[model samples]
Target: MKVKSAATQVHREQPLVLGYKVDIARQESVKAMYDSLVEVFNARLDSLINNTAQMEPYKPFLESDPDTYWRTWEVNIQGLFNMARTFFPMLSEQSLQVVYGEQGLWASCVNPGAIKIKITAGALEAVRNVLPDRLAIAGDTIAWLASDRKEWLGGRYISCPWDMEELVAKKDEIAKEDALKLRLVV
Candidate 1:
């Protein structure tokens, strides 16, 4: 219901916006979405933000249902992988435009720092004890990322709590250290 309401609101704001229910964990579903998108936009996509995730109810691992625990991994990891793999061609097509000096793709995994949403309000009530960050922190960060302003951050993980100006200042250092990527630390 929340998803539908959000979609309706976006469609109201932008008449061209199209919404479809998809199970990202399924390859066929992802393909259908890709097909629909290709048909609508004539095989052109400027940007793709893969933001599908799932969280099982907060519980101890030993007490958690095995299926439910794995489901979160399926949606969070496999779903994101499926979306990225399926959309790579269209995304690459957009990148090709860079040959002509046009702005290209800027993709990243955004961690919208602990904002209070439906799930947070319910399943994550423990967060209620802590002050949640404003929605604008994530919204503004994503808005900046959608623009051509920060291509260097592509293929990186970005936290909404990080200051963009500070991030930019340390871009070289970040690249040198290959930071912001998932890696095992000693």
Candidate 2:
């Protein structure tokens, strides 16, 4: 349960897995971040997942530099890529079930305003296309189509107490996906 900057390496002796806070503002930083993470978890981890809310706000420089935008994209988008590729095999049904418990916070389109919505939505779409089913996805907010259809990676979408049941239902859906996706193996 240790949280560290993306640049840091995971500590091998720590009993709990490591979580890196990525800054999606620079491309090189993203590469450096994942490279370091991969190095640590290559053989040491039993399972791997990410808490997307850990991504920091988009910096003003992110818009100014095309390279930076793509870098942010890599961190937000490719970060998932690296995580899945690096740790997909280690994830199993039991491991996936408890991996994300109480560790995530749902993000709202209003939390960081409209810009985050666009970026997060774009990244989410990209991951959905390439992501393998073996890993579990946990997130704070559930994105829905205009028809109220939930996205593939389900989570709670609303903030009020009345929505708790809906959130629980969505959580169940995600858990099922986690199991189905990993069905090929144990």
| Candidate number with greatest lDDT | 1
Candidate 2 at 75: error in angstroms? 0.6
For each candidate in turn, the TM-score is: 0.78, 0.33
Provide the RMSD of all predictions against the true structure, rounded to 1 decimal.
5.2, 13.9
lDDT of 2 by residue, 43-143 (tens): 33332334343333334653565765556576666665665544443443224311233433111221222233323443445554554322111122322
Question: Model 2 lDDT vs. the true structure?
Answer: 0.40
| C-alpha local distance difference test of each model | 0.76, 0.40
Output the lDDT of residue 32, model 2: 65
Question: Per-residue lDDT tens digits of candidate 1, residues 6-95?
Answer: 768878542366889999999899999999999999998766777666777777768889998788898988998898789878877768
lDDT of 2 at 80: 59
Best by TM-score: 1
